[model samples]
Each structure stands twice: as structure tokens, then as C-alpha cells.
Target: MYKGYFGLKESPFSIAPNPRFLFMSERHKEALAHLSYGLGETGGFALLTGEVGTGKTTISRRLMEQLPENTQAAFILNPTLSSQELLATICDELKIRYRKTGATLKTLTDKIYEKLNKNHQAKLNTLLIIDEAQHLAPEVLEQLRLLTNLETDTKKLLQVILIGQPELKQLLQRRDLRQLAQRITARYHLLPLTKGEVGHYIQHRLSVAQCDRMLFERAAVAEIHRISQGIPRIINLLCERSLTNAYCSNNALVTKKIVLLSAQEALGDEYQATFWWQHKAVKALAASAVFAVIVSSSYFLGQLYGENISEKSALNITAPAVNQVVSDTSSPAIIVADNEKIPDENAAKAITDNTAKVFKIESDGDKKRAVEQRIVKTDKPASIPMPVENSAEQLSNLADSKLAEDKATSKVKEKLSVKAVDGVSDDLLALFQSAIDDTEQDPQFKNSANQVVTPEVNAPALSDMPAWVQSDLPSLSFEQHIYTSEGESWVKVNGRDRYQGDTISEELVLNYIYAQKVILTFKGQQFSLPALSSW
Candidate 1:
């Protein structure tokens, strides 16, 4: 259909075995050389094997064309026959007469030997080429090997060429066929075309079809090679479909897009569907792993630095008192004078706050101690008169309170020193430093300075609030939500359906769709739009 449209005399990519369209790659040339050498030498068996559609038959055809005029070749296109039937077919190919009704194995063999002997005397070589030799039965193959045994000391009477797929190689390796395998003097395995050769192959076929100009783009040729895996038959199928599609679309040249579509058509729905799902699964798994790593790292850094900051704040508030006690044990009078200068209620509250910040205390016992300390330190004695019997109790309580205060201060100093030492450890310090550096270098942190740091599970729903929450952005309205059912999710933005992971515009893109939320990037800002449904 497209031959005239593309200015071609014939279909360039027909799967038919045409010698004019054959592209002799390096491997093909080497395979021919092996076959030629095997036939020239006094050989028992010559072997040529390759994968399906790798030009094995083309090589065989070329070999036949180059045979010497003195050679009498018998081609067997089918090898599914009994030993006697095979010999009868050979006799028929050689024009040897035999009884049609009562042709037994002995009769066929004697006739073949007589024919071979006659050919030998006439200085004519007998070559038997069996196509699809892999399907030959063990007994039939053994019988054929036995025929080769009827040779003179100088040369074999019969030369056989076995050509088939890669299975033929395995077939020859059986223990039962070891004797026959030892007689194989020459063998060559043909490989598929290289990437560079695929281009030349297409061009060669196009030239044979009488087209002068290049019809396929370079990238299209590359895509063909990639999809077809350099197999000639598959390449032919894809190129043929691609050209047909281009011709139908009225395209002047075949492009990569056309080739892709053509491949999907030619390779069938099962392959395309399987490849599509596998690609998606791999991408999703990789994305999930990266997300997990980032989230885990961020959470760890937050916890580590949060504790460091809280401890630093506590140290700043209590460092002066700790230093005062450590510097002078004889300055107890000076400490008491400093304590008395502050108002009783204010001093007690400061002490209680410091203790609460350091120890996270929740008991009423600690608060009662603060109140008693305040009462004893108050300057106005006339405003709060004490009973005569409780005055001695107050004195004893004051002494006990003083001892407790000293012990508590010493404990706080010890804890602070220990924490300071721990904070300066090599591993801990390195961890804290790395966390700080990562935060400073993070691209998201630089872009959104005031962005809230929250866990994924605690992400807020978009629909529960107004479209634009800030009062400054009352006019800007862009609403998007996710709808999920049966394990798939879709994004709907302002009444327009958008596929996930595709860019809506230059400034807006649907990044991902989770079960509970859809992540989007709008004008350099990322938003996690929650799903309207529960799941």
C-alpha cells in the first residue's frame, strides 16, 4: 500500500526470504565461511545453528548459490521422517530408482550407497542439507551417521549439513549422539545483528526496493533496534507497520512516535501491557523507597536537634547559679543576700519554673516546698504572724529546707556537666553537625522559609477549610482534590480531570497520588491535597 507513496518498487520489510533483501552482517559472512570450509574439507558433518529469524535460512540459500558445479546437493526442507523414509527421500532427490511399494531400510541404504559410489567415481560430491534438523529422531540421525561411515580412507562418501535453531546444539550433546557429535568437523553459531547493522539492514532493503532517500529518522531507527532487540524478523515486522502507519497518516517520514505505536501494534497487547505494568511498578517502588529515606532522615534530624535546643535553653538559664556554687564554697552569705534582694513570690516562682524546666516535675509536693520557702523568706513578719508552738517547727523546717536546697543544686550541677560531656562526644557531635548542614542545604527549606514541618499522617485535608486560608490571598483560588477507589486515585482540579504525575501547565503539576492525598507542585510550591474519601 505504501510502496508508491514512499517511492519504492517493492515492500522493503516483507518477511519473505528474498535473497536481494538479505543484509550480510559480519556474523552472516563468518557463518558462510564456516559452511564453505566444512564442505570443501573431507568432513563427516557440518553444523550451523542460530536463534530463530537470525538469517540462518538466508545463509543456507547463499551457500546453495555458491556450490561447485560438480556438487550434487539434496535439500530436505522437512526432517520429520523415519530412517527408511529419509533414505527414500534422498534417493528420490538423487534420481535413484527404487521399488515404491517395498522400499525397506536395507533397500534404501543399498541404493544410496550405489548412488554415492557412482557420484564419487564421476568426481561429483554429494551434499545433503537438512533444514530444521533439530526435529530429527535419534534413530534417524543415527542411521544418517551410519551412512557417513561408508567412506574411503581419503574422503567421506557423504557430506551432511545440519541447520536449525539453538536447540540443535543441545540436541547434539545427548550421550546417545556422542559418536555422531565427534564427527562434526566444522560448526558455526550465527548471532543477531548489531545496533549499527540494523540501520544498514533497513537501508539495504530500502535500496533493494529502489528507494534513494532515507525514510526513517535516525532516532526512529534506534528505537526500532531497541524494541526489536536486533532480530531481523521482528525488525521487519515493526518497520513494515511503522511505514504503513506513516503512509496512512500522510506523514512524509517515519518518526519515533510512529515506531512506538507500530511496535505496540506489532508486538501484540500482551507484551505491551506487561511492559507497561512492569515499568510502572518499578517506578513506583523506586519513588516509595526515596520518599521513605527522606522522611526517615528528616524525622531523625528533627528529634535530635529538638532535644539539643531544649537542653541548650535550660543550660543558659541555670548556668549562673551552677557556676556561683562551683566557684566559691565560702560565699554562702553572698548567695543568701542575692536571694533576699528579689521579692519572695518572684524568687520562689523563678526557682519553681527552673526546676520544672529541668526535671519535668508534676507533683504537688514540689509546689508545697516552693510555698514554704516563700513564707520563710518574706520580709514583712507582721503581715503573717505564726503560732508560738509552730515557731520551733518552722526553725527546724528552715534548716531541713536549706540542706535540701544544697543537695538539689549539687544534683542539677552534676546533671548539667554530664549532659555537656555527652553533647560533645565525637559521634553525637558529628550527627548534630550533619543535621544542621542538611537543613541549611535543603532546597525545600530554602524556598519555603516558614513552611510547617509535619508528619505525612498528620497532613491536613484541603476541603475542610476555605480555598485560600490566608487573609492576604482571598482572591487566589485553586482547589484540587483526590478521589480514590479500588486502589487507584485520580486528581480533579477546579472541575478538570488531570492524570496523576503529569504536568498540567508550566506552573502546575500533579506529582503523586497517595491513598489519602495527592501531592502537587504549583509555581514552585508543593501541596498535599487530601483525598475526599476515607481510602
Candidate 2:
């Protein structure tokens, strides 16, 4: 709208990347130099990427224009094609003829190869330039790579240049695409223009459009840079809108105010609402929200941490039994009591809650033993006299039983005291004498000195059996079981006692006294014989 008013031949700020209106900022020159050098060195591939409208496409076109007269270039404007479609498109771009009815990817590729060979024979280089190359699929890009492989030892048949947004660089970096990426040989990321370049950039375009004087104020150029962030496409859009607004008002030069208003209408909706974050109220609101999230997270985390504690608190026993267990000083009760001080307040609160279930102890005995077994194992003082008790009537019954026991003991002593008789074995005499002498001799055991005791072994060992055994087994003329320094039990026989002096039998030995039998060994093996009958 303002081109005529500003003495311009046409719209200078059109977003289309026209060659006549091209402005090569310093970075653009470096990028072009890098990519051109790459294509010159190897006929493989070159990569040029940039933000939207940073002039990647325009610069690539410039590269094509700069190619030698012997070079034939194929430009692909839209790369969003399948492998077969892309191969056909490449053939079309190179003017390589193929049967359109049966053009498979292989057929199209073969035609391209023939063209490349023909170009090589004629001393012409083939270059394929794909704009917006980021949209090319992995398989399609792979197909392009295969075309580059049709080469002689000196150079690739196809010198490919890939131009796209920054995402093209990312796409090439894929694990599947690294082979193609490595062949690129050279790559450059075109950045947006600097704030200072925006002024010169505007004047260069104005000059191309036949404008002799500066049509935009200095402040307006700065505003343009701010609104567009130096992106070429957005800069052109804002400058165009600003020019229209200025023309509507019949203003001579586009001002900063015009650029600002134009940008408000152009980019307002897509822009994020972040300015409010600087306000005190909004900052406070965000802080509160963060605090709430943290608190909620901690609460759930605490519950997860307390799962073990809750499991330990669950007891298998009934409530009354659990209360009884708590009275004991074992580790489980103490650990449950100490859970109140856990660092996680919520966890601790749950564990120490009054209504929480009580848990059984972790001790192996606790898991396996019956209640009675556990009670008997304890060192506690109090216990029920459930099985046995002391009383006057009970004492009388015990006294009668005691009297019968004494008469029986007396009869055993008398019988055991018999002298050797004809036909009676001499071995019986020593064993009988040992039994007679083992009767209690101490005043403490005198009232019931008739308890029968076994003499341990041959002669001397009989006195070394046990000290308590000596109290009931009084010292007699014959060998007897008696206390001694050695730990082994010993017994005497009339035949062996006279010769073998108090030596214990280290091997299995037995002595049968009528129906009462005794087994003894030096290894401390003892046998409890059943009660002898009164007969």
C-alpha cells in the first residue's frame, strides 16, 4: 500500500524469498561459503539449516546461481514424499525420462543413474537441492543416500544439498540417518539477523525496490527487530503491516508506534501471557501453588515410607493377648513404643495411633512357640501353680507315699547287703556291697538314707561319679559311686575291683542286678532304669 507513496517499484517487504530483494547478512555469507566449499570438495551432501525465514532457501538458491556452467541443478521445494514418490520427483527434476506407467522406485532410480552417468561423461556435475528437507522421511532420505552412492572413485554422482529448518539438522542426527549425516561433509546453522543488521537489511530491500530515501524511522526499525526477534519472515510481515497502517493514516514515515500496534494485531493471540508473572500478586499465587504441590507430594511419600511400620504393627493374636505381650520388655514392644519419634510426622502419627492393631514380635521363638512354651522360657518370677500345689491334705498323702517308699528302700538295702553264698556269683557281691554303701550317710539326708544309687565302675572311679550321689550313697567297706576330681562315672565288681583299681570302662559295659539293668560307658552315656518291683 505504501510502496507508491514511498517511491518504490514494488512491495519490498514481501515474505517470498525473491532473488532481486535478497540481503546477505554477515552470517549468511559465512553459511554460504561453508556449504559451497563442502559441495566443491566432495560430491556427497551439504546441510544448511536455519530458523523459519532466516533465508536458508534464498541462500541455497544463491548457491545454485553461483554453480559453474558445467553443473546441472535439481531443486526440490517440497520433500514430504514417500520413497517412491521422492525418487520419481527427483527424476522429474533432472528431466530424466522413464516409462510413467511402470515407474517403480527402482525404475525411477535407474533413470536418474543414467542421467548422472551422461552428465559425468559430458563433464557436467549433478546437484540435488531439497528445500524443507526436514520433512523427508527416513526411508526417503535413505533412498537419496543410495543415489549418491552411484559414483566413481573421484566424486559422488549426485552432489546433494539439504536446506531446511533447524529440525532438519535434528532429523539427520537420528541413529538411522547418521550415515547420510556423515556424508554431509559440511553443515551450517543460519541464525537470525542482529538488531544492527535489521536497519541495513531494511534499507537494502528499499534500495532494491527503488526507494532512494529511508521510509521507516530508526525507532520503527528497532521495534520491528523486537517484534520479529530478527526473524526475516516476521520482520517482513511487521514492516508490511506497519507500512499499511502508516498509509491508512497518511503518515509520511512508519514510526515505532505504528510497528507496535501492527504487531499487537498480528502476533497477540499466539504470544504467551507471561507478563503477569512479574506482578506481586501473580508471583505470590505461584509460590502458594508450589507450596501446595510440595505438601501434597510429601504426604503421599510419607505414607509409602510408613508401609513397613504399619505392617509391623499388625499382630496375629487377639486384642487381649496383644495387650499382655506389650507388658513384656521384649524388643517388639519397645520398637513399637519408639515409633512415635519417627522423622516423618504422618508416618509416626499412624504408627502411634491409639486404634492401630498390635503386631507379633519378630523373634523366631515368638513366631513358632506356643504361649505356654514362651512363658516357661521367660525369666519372669510369677507363674500359675496349675499342675501342682502344697496343702495339709496333700502333704498327708505325700507322707503316706513316703512311708511306703522308706520300707521298700530298707528291704532293698537288706537284700543288697547279703554276703557271698555258694552258687551266687562273686560279681554279685561287690555290686550288692556298692548298693548298700550308697545309702545316705549325711545328717541332711539321714532321715531318708535308703534311696538306691548305682556304683559307677571298676574300683576308684566309683567315688568320682557325683558329689550329690555320695550324699545318698554312704561310704561303705565295699566300692561305691562317690565324688572325685575326674568327671567320669565308675563302678566296682568283686572280681575286677580287687585288681583293677578304680578305672572306668571306656567301652560298652553292662551289669545286670536280678531284673534291674545298668549300662555305663566312659563317654558319659547314662541310662535311667524303671522302678524295681517290691517283690
Candidate 3:
């Protein structure tokens, strides 16, 4: 199709065994010389083996052209036949006719021997060339060996040439066929063309097709050789496909890119994997990227959720000092005071009213100071003497003392209010109050206070937990799972000591178990717990 466009007389890369287009390299020349030498002698057998499409038949045809005029050649294209059929076919090829129907093996062999003898008497060389001889049965090959035994005193009358793929060489190595192998006087294996020969081969064919200009670029030829692996048939296929592609694109000269595209089209999957990134390198890069993303995401999540907080920071906040008093001392003091005092309902009501007054103080500093003073005054040693006075007198005296203390506190507040106009002690008090308010409102301070005031034996406060821990994270944790040989499934949930059934809790139940994942229903919601391979 591309001949006229490329100034060629015909397609250069046709796979037909055309002698005019044969470009014999050194290997091909050597192979031809070997075959010629084998055929020249009165040989029992000459063997020629090559890989598929290495031009074994081409060399054989060339050998035929170089043979003398007295040569009688009988070609057997297919060797897949029984002993009788093979002999009959050989007789038919050599014009040694026999009974058309019901021909016994002996009858066919006798006819072939008669022809061989007649050819020898005429002083003519009789040649039997079997193509694809690898398919010949062992018994049929043995029969051929027996036919070779029909020899004269000087040399064998019938000459046999076996040309086939490399497997034919292996076939000859069989123990039963060792005798036949011993008779093979000459054997030659044909190898594919070399890289340099591939370029010369294309030019030779193009020249034979009557083209003068170079059609394939230098790099393009190298690429063709690489893709074809110096195999002539594969090179022809790739070059033809590349030429057609260049023709389709109206390209004047074929480039390496064109050759690459042709290889992908002609070779398909065999060449698809030739790309540098399609195999281990790309997979390794992708795996590295995935691992990096996972590690970075894990670190970011730990920081955001405070999961990476140091143990020292948590312990520092939780440890209490010896002199630090908690604000909830009123409960214990009231409980102790109530146990000690067995007074009437009126005195108890008076005490309760004073306690409520003390609690109602809004300023934390003033309240703390007042409570400390009251505790100090009321807390006397057990050995201290009690005042000898009536319960009403004692309660009245206590009430009178509380009223005097309140009046004194009011006077001090009034003095501070007057000092506010002067902006002396009042500003200091305001600054102190602001500092106290800020400390109380500070989250860190509150967290530390909560940790210190609460005993470690009690359950932790949920509010103090990290945000991600308190958030709606996946409820189920897959510690481990096992499947028995009989296919019974069991799993440990949340690293619990015992194995739970499919139903773990009233609200959570196992739904399905897979090799890499476990499904569960948590509070009527379905979720998946992925199996962690490592920490």
C-alpha cells in the first residue's frame, strides 16, 4: 500500500520467501554452506534446525538453487503421517506409483526403494527434504532410519534432509531415536540476525524493491531492532506496521516515535509492559506516596486532637501542692459543725442563715478570706472549755458578733469606695479582681484544678478528655480475629479479655466478618472497623 508513496516498486517487508529480497547475513551464509556440504556427500541424514522464522526455509531454497542439474528433489511439506502414509506420499512425490487403495506399508517402502535404486543406476542424486520434521512420529522416524540402511558398499543411495524448529534437535536426543541421531552426519542451527544486520536487511529489501531514498531514520531502525529482538519475521511485521502508520500520517520519513507506536499496535501486550513506569518503579513510587500521606495525616490528627500531649504535662497539672486549699471546704466544715452542735431549731436556723450569708458573697477573694477567718475562729481544740451561758444567750452573742463583723466589713468597703476617687488602693483592688477573674476563666487553670481536686480513683471527667476522644470516633476496635478450620468466626473487641458473641452489647452487634474488615451495628448505625496490620 505504501510502495508508491515511498517511491518503491513493491512492499519491501512482505513475509513471503522471495529469493530476490533475501539478505543473507554471515550466519545465513554459514547455514547455507553447511546445508550445501551436507547435501554434497552421499549422506544418511542432514539436519537443519532454527528458531521459528529465522529463514531456515530461505537458506534451504538457496541450497536448492545451487544444486547440480542431475539432482532429483522430493519435498515433503508436512511430515505428520503414519509409516505407510509417509512412504506412500514419498513415492507419489518421486513418481514411484503404487496401488492407490489398500496399499500396505511394505508395498509403499518397496516402491520408494525401487525408485532410489533406479535413480542411483542413472547416476542421479535422490534427495528427500522433509519440512517441519519435528512432528514426525518416533516409529515413522525409525522407518526412515531403516530406509537409510538400504545402502551400497561405497555410500547411501537416498539422501534425507530434516529442516524444522529447535525442538527437532531435542527430538533427535530421545533414547529410542539415538540410532537415527548417530546417522546425522551434518547439523547446523540458524540464529537470528544481528543488530547491525537488521539495518542492512531493511535497506537491502528496500533496494530490491527499487527504492533509493532511506525510508527509516537511524534511531527508528535501532528501535525496530530492539522491539523485534533481531528476529527477521518480527522486524518485518514492525517495519510494515510502522510504514503503514507513517503513510497514514503523510509522514515523509519514519521516526522512532512512529516505530514505538507501531510496536504497541503490532506487539500489543508484549510491548505494553516495556514502558519504564509500568512495572516495579511506578508501583514503588506510588507506595511511597501513600505511606507518606498516611504518616503525615496521623501526625496531623494527633496534634489536632491533643493525643500527643506529654505525660509530664498531664502529671504536672494533676499533682496537688500541700498548702493549696480547695474552694469546697464548706461542706466538710458544715458537716463537722453539725455533728458537734446539738442545739434547738432556732439556733440551728440562725447558724444556717449565717452560712447562707457567707456563701452569697459575690467576690471570691472576700468570700475565701471570710470563710477562712470563720473556720479559724470556730475551730477550737477539743480540750478547750465551753462558756457557761444559756443557749439563747450564746446564740445572741454569736449573732451580735457576726453583725459587728459585717458592719466592720461595710466600713472597709466604704473606705475603699472613697479611695477609688483618689485612684490609689481601689485601682490595685480592681487589678487584683481582674487577675483573679482571668485565672478562674482560664481553661488551663480550670483543667489543672479539676485534675488536682478530683481523686485519681474516681472516673475522669468527660469534659477534660481530648476533643477527638470525646468526638464520635468509630466505636468498635478490632483487636484480633480468628477463623477456625471449620469456618467458625470469633473476634476480640476493644482488646477485651473475653471473646464476645456476634452481639457484643445491647446496642452494638457484629454484622459481617471479612478478611480485612469487620462490620458492626452500633446503636442502629452500621460502621466498618478496618483491621490494623501494625501500630
Among the numbered candidates, top lDDT falls to 1
Which ranges of candidate 2 are over 4 A from the true structure? 271-535
**Candidate 2 or 3, higher TM-score?**
3
TM-score to true structure, per model = 0.57, 0.51, 0.52
- 1-535: candidate 1 lDDT, tens digit per residue: 9998999998989998777788988888889999998886588899998777788888888888899999999999889998988998999898999999988999999999999999999999999999999999999999999999888878998999999987787788899999999999999977667678999999999999999988999999988876776789999999999999999999999999999899889988633532554454476666556866887889799677657556656555322222222243332222222233433232223254212111122348546322222212222222212223454786799899978756764543343231235436776545434443343243332212333222332334434434543222212223334333222234544323455566666666766665345665556556555454221
> Model 2 over residues 421-441: C-alpha lDDT tens digits?
998788656655554464344
Top TM-score prediction, candidate number:
1
Clashes of each: 0, 11, 0
The alpha-carbon deviation from the true structure for residue 527 of candidate 1, after best TM-score superposition, in angstroms, is: 41
Q: Cα lDDT of all candidates, in order?
A: 0.70, 0.65, 0.68
Give per-residue CA lDDT, model 3, range 1-535, as digits (tens): 7877898888889888777777889888888877777776567899998777788877777777777988898889889999988998888889887889998988888888888899889998888899999999999999999988888887888889999987787688899999999998888877666668899999998899998878999999978876676778888889899999999999999999999899989888877535766443475466556756887888699565453234434444322112223376544332223224432222112234324222222257545322321221123223322223244686799899978756764543343232243545765556534443333243322222132111111223334445644464344455456422122334646433112224676666665443334555556555455543211
Clashing pairs in 1: none
Better of 1 and 2 by lDDT: 1
Clashes of 2: 11
